[model samples]
Target: GKEQKQLASELARKGVTKEQAMRVKQLYEQQNNVNASNATGTDVNESRLREEMKENTSDMLEDHPSTQDLARSNQVFGRNIFNTRNLTFEPSVNIATPLYYRLGPGDEVIIDIWAASQNTIRQQISPDGTINIQKIGPVNLNGLTISEANDYLKKTLNKIYNGLNNTNDPTSAIRLTLGSIRPIQINVMGEVVQPGTYSLSSFSTVFHALYRAGGVSDIGSLRNVQLVRNGKNIATIDVYQFIMKGNIQDDIRLQEGDVVIVPAYDILVKVDGKVKRPMRFEMKKDESLSTLISYAGGFDADAYTRSLRVVRQNGQEYEVNTVKDLDYSVYKMRNGDVVTAEAILNRFINKLEIRGAVYRPGIYQLNGKLNTVRELVNEAQGLTGDAFLNRAVLYRQREDLTTEVIPVDIKAIMDGTSQNIILVKNDILYIPSIHDLEDRGDVVIHGEVAKPDSYPYADNMTLEDLIIQAGGLREAAS
Candidate 1:
C-alpha cells in the first residue's frame, strides 16, 4: 500500500490522477508478491517499481506495445538505426582489378611518369591494342593487362638506355603507373528528375549512383525499389529498411554503363467510385490508408468503408484479396496500386465537369483549389487561340451533393507577374485557336529608319550598333 501511495504521488506529478495510479500500482504489487511467494524467493515488494517509473519519465517504457511494433522488422548490420545512405562504412575496398593490375585493349589505364608530364598519360588502349606516347612511340600492348604492359615497357626502356647511357641500375629506376579504370557511366531513366550519365570512379553503392542521378522521383518509394542489370532484374532493394533501419547491404555496388531506372511511384490507391474526392493518391511516408483516405478528402457520402479494395499494380496488375482497415495502406506500394472506396447504400457523390482553352484539355483531377485551373492549363499546354484569360470557375459539390461554381480571375498571368497556379490533375482546359500577335516597343533611330520602324527590344545600342553593315539599316533608311 505504501509503495502504491508513492506511485500515486508520482502519477500526480505527471498530471495522472492519484486514484487510478494507486489502483494500478497496488495491482502490480499484488501480482509480484504472489509470484515471489510461489517461487519461495521471499522478495519483498519494494518501491523500486515506482522509482523506475519516476526515473524513466523521459524515456518510453520498453514494454510499450507501440514501441515493440515499431521495432518489428528493422534490423540492419545488427543495428536498427543503421543508415543505408551513408554506410560511412568504407566497405572492404572493392579492389576493381586488385589495384596493381595491368590493362589491355578495352581495359582503361592511366600512366604517369614522375619525371615528365608528357610521358605520363591517362587514356585507354586503342582498338589496335597499341598506345602512342610522346617519347616512347607506339607500344604494341594489346593483350597485356596493366601490370604486364608496365613490365614490358620497363624491360624495353632498360635495354635501350643501358646500351646507350651505360646505366647499370636500369630496371629499378623506371616507375610506371597505371591509373584507375575510367569512370563508368550508368544510364538512369524512368521517374528521376535529372536523368543522365553518372561517372563511376570507384565502386559505389546504388544510393551513390542515385545521388549522382539526382535522387528518386518525388512519387518514388524507397521500399521495393528494383535494380535491373544486364537486361535482368537482379535485385529488389528495400529503400525503407535502408531509410529506417540503415540497411547498407541493399545499396549494391554498380558497374560500368549500368542503366539505373527509377520507375514512377506505381503503388497508388485509387479513390474512385464513392470517395468524396476521387483520384490516384500516393502513400505518404510512414503513413496508412486511414491517413491516405483522409488526405484524399475522406470517404464520400456514399463511400462504403467496409468494402474498400486495394488493387496494386505490379508489372501488369493484381487485385489484393481484401483490406480490413487503413493500416493496409502501409503495405509497400509498388509502381501502381488502385484503392477504391465503394459507394455506400443510400448516398452518392456529385459529379464535376471541367472544360476550357488550356494546355491540356481534359476532365482533370479536382482538389477544389481555387487556382487549380492554372495548373491544368499549363499541363494541357497553356491556353491557345483566344482563351478567356480573365476568369475561371470553381465547381464544388455541396454537402447535399449539389454543385456550386465560383468564378476566378487570372489576368495576372499575361503580365508576366503573379505566381503560376498549380493544376489539380485531371482538369479540363478548353483552348480555341490562336492567330499571330504583334507588339511594338521602345525604339531609337541613330543612323536611319526607312519608315521609322527599325529599333526594337535590344540592349546597349551604340553608334556602331546602328551601323551593323556597310550599307547600314538600308540605303534609303540610312
Candidate 2:
C-alpha cells in the first residue's frame, strides 16, 4: 500500500489522472509479482529486467492523455520516436555478411577448398586474433576483410595444395565465407533513454546500438550523435539526414568497445500556425529559418507567405519581430525562438454582391468593365421588370470600417441623366421589387360567418363580398 501510494504521488506530480494512476499501480504490482515468482534459480539478468521495467513504465506514461497534451504544447519533437512499442530497430542476423566486415575475436570462419581433393575446414578466431589451420598452423584473420583474409589464406595453403593459384582451372577453387558471427560490447552514454553497455552483433551499426540503448532522450540532440572509438571521436551521426532524406550514409558500423554518445540539444525552435507539420525542431548552429521551415514541411496552403512572425527570448525579455520573405534564407535562428505563419484574411479584394431584383443576383467582379452601377446591372442581365428603379440602396464600407447606406437613383443612372457612381471592393447593391413597396393587407371576417378566417383584401370590396368569401353566414348569425 505504501509503494502504491508513492507511485500514485509520482504519477500525480506528472499530471496523471486518479484512474490512470490506479491502472499504472495495478500493472506495477502485476509486474512485481511476476518478477518475484521467477526469482528462484532463474539466473535472471538484473540489468535487463530493470530496462524492461523502465520501458514498461515509459510506455504507460506515454499512453497518458497528458503526454499528448504536452507534445502539442510545444514539447520537443523526435523525443517520442524511441517511446514507441512497434519499432524496435533491432539488427537483423540473417543478412549477408558485408564485404567490409573486419574479422574479430570469437568470429567463426568457414573455409572450403576443392582441387583434386575436397576438404572443408571450420575455425573460430581466437582472442589473440589467430585461427589454427589443419596443417598450416595459426594465421591471424583479425582486422582483415573477407577478401583480404581469403587472399592471405590461399598464399599460406599453396605449399600443400597444387594448382591453388591457377585461376583458369575450372576444377580448382577456394572459397571463404562467414559462419556464426561474434558479439561486440558497446557503451551508449550521455543523453540517451538508457545509458549502458550492450552486447550487440559484430555487424551492428550506430543505429543498432542506439536502439538497444532505448534511443535518445527528450533533451538529446539527434543531429550530433557522436561515435567515439579508442578515446577519439571518429564520426558524428546526424539522424535528421536519415529522417528527412532517407540517407543512411553516416550510419557507420560499430566496433567492439565503441562509445555512442548523444549530446544535449544545442538549439531548439518551435514552429506553429499555418504550417504543414508544426512542431519543435532542433537546429544546427548555422541553420537558417528557411531550413527550419523546410524541416516543418513548409507552409500550409492558406498561409500568408508574405511575412512571418517570430517571438524570440532576448535574455531578460521577449522580443517580437517580423521576418519578410526575402530574409527567410538569411535569418539565423536562435534557441527558444517561436515562429508563426498566419493565414490569409477571409475577405476578397475585387468583389461586389447584388441582391433582390437583378436577373442573376449574386456576387460579381469589380473590374474595369464592371466598375459603374449601370455596368454591373448590364453584366447581371439588367434588373428585373418589377425592380424599383426610383431609388436603390448601396451598402458601402467607409474608411473607418463603418457601413454607409447610399440612396441610388437607378432610373436617372440608367438613362444617363445623373453621374454613375463607381463601385469599389465589398460594395453590396440591393434593388427592391415593386411588390415590396406596396402594403398588401388581409381582411378578417369573424362572429356570424360560417368560416371564421382571414382573406386577401381587394380595393372597394363590400361586406356581402367579404361574407361570401368566408363561406356565408351561419344559422346562429345576428
Candidate 3:
C-alpha cells in the first residue's frame, strides 16, 4: 500500500492528475491481487493448445467443405443472386443511355454564341483545359466542365458587353448542352458472320454490335455473349434472353474498346459404336434420338439399340435400351453426349478377339457393339477373299469357356427376319479370317492408348482416348 502511494505520487509528477494517478494505482493493485482476468481451473497449455489447433485446422482442410461454410463464401454470395448495382463506375456505350459528364482535357466541345462573328468566336479548350475568348481575354476553364466553362465565359462576356454597350444589361445567363458522339466506333470479333469495327451514329447496345457484326455466324450462340471493356471481361450477357425473352435489361450498352464475342454454338453429339457413320453431327434444338440415328444412317441390323448408352463429359451416363422403346427410333440427345449402340456379332462375355483389318483395330469393350454382319465383314475385309457364307457364324461362350456358334445368314437378316442379335457389355465378337502365315501376329496398337491394342478391332477404343494415350497423336501429322 505504501509502494502504491509512491507509484501514484510518481505518476502525478508526470502531469497525471492526482485523482487519475490514484485510480490507476488502486486499479493495478486490485487487478494483480484479485486476478481481474477470467480465472480458469483448466489452464490451457500454449504448446498443447497450439498443437491441437494445428490438428483441427488440418482436419478442417481435409474434410469435404460443408455447405453452410460454402454458403458464407463470397462466391456463393453471387451464386444465388447478387449485383454490383452499388458500383459507381460502369462504363457504358456512347449513347444508348444518355450519360452526363463534365469536361476534361482531350474532350471535344462545341459552344454556340448568338453574338456577331466579330463579337463571338469558335474556340477549343486548350491542353490546360482553358479557353480564351476575344473580349473575355483569358477565362480560366481548366478542370471545369463545359457547363461551368460556359458559365465562366457568359459572365465574362456579359461584363465586357455591359461595359462596351452600357445600355445592354449584362444579365443574360449561360446554358450548356453536352452533345452526343455522332459516330461512335466499336470492335466486334470471334465466331461472328461479319466481324469488324463498326461506326455508330449514336452509342449503341450489344444488339447493334451484333447487327453490325453481320448478326453472328450460323454456329454462333447469342445466349453466352461476352462483353469485354478496356481489354477485360466486364459482363457475360444473355443475348438469347434479350431476344427471345425480351429482357431488355440483359442487353447492356457497349462502350468503345468493348469487344463483343459471340461464342460458337455447341451442337454436336459423338455417335460411336454400331452406326454406319461415326461422326459429330451438328445438333438442333428439336433434335431427338431419331435425328441422331438418322444422322448415323439409321441403325445397323445387328445394333444393340437396347443398350444405348449416353456418356457425358464427366463420365456420368444415361443408358437407354432403344430396343426397350418398342419403337426403337426416338431418344432426345444432348450436346457432347456419346451414344453407344450395341453390336450385332456374338460376344464371349469377357473374352473376345478383334481379328479384323482396321486402322488401329483391336478387341475393345467386352459387349461393345459392332454393326451389321456386313460391318464385321468389312472390319475383316469381307473374309479376306477366302471366307464362305456357309462358314460364317458369330461364336459365343460362357465365362467357363462353354461355346455355342450361331450361323448368321447376312442375306436373310438383311431381308428382315433376323433378330439381329443386340450387343451387351463385356461381350467380345470374333470376326475370324484366314491369316497369311508370314503375318506372324495380328495388328497391334500401343503406347498411349487406355488399353494397348494388339488385335485389329473397330469399336470400343475411341480416337480421342487413343490420341490421349499415344502422347497426343503427333500434332504435325494431324
What do the candidate models score in CA lDDT, each in turn?
0.54, 0.86, 0.54
Question: Over the full model, what C-alpha lDDT does candidate 2 score relative to the true structure?
Answer: 0.86
- Evaluate residue 403 in candidate 3 and report its C-alpha lDDT on the 0 to 100 scale: 70
List of clashing residue pairs for candidate 2: none
Per-candidate RMSD vs. true structure? 34.2, 16.8, 26.8
Q: Highest TM-score: which candidate?
A: 2
Cα lDDT, model 2, residue 280: 92
Error of 3 at 356 (Å): 70
Q: How far out, in Å, is residue 284 in model 2?
A: 1.4
| Sliding window of 10 residues with minimal summed lDDT for model 2 | 41-50
User: Which of 1 and 3 is ahead in TM-score?
Assistant: 3
Q: Which residue runs does candidate 3 get wrong by more than 4 Å? A: 1-172, 178-182, 266-478
Please, what are the lDDT tens digits per residue for candidate 3 over residues 1-478?
7865675565444444555544554545554544436375224443444455445434534553444433332121111111123422223544332323444434445555443322334455566766566655665655564556666666566664443232364333344444433345788888777788877543367776776566656456654678888878988775534423467776666654578887876655667667776655555566687766775677777787655667666456554433354444555566677677868668444433444333333554333445444444444444444333333456665567677766666545544566565433334444334443225544466654445555543346666654555455443352
Question: Which candidate, 1 or 2, would have the higher lDDT against the true structure?
Answer: 2
Identify the runs in model 2 with alpha carbons over 4 angstroms from their true place: 1-70, 115-117, 167-171, 381-386, 411-419, 434-478
Which candidate model has the greater TM-score, 1 or 2?
Answer: 2
User: What C-alpha lDDT does candidate 1 achieve relative to the native structure?
Assistant: 0.54
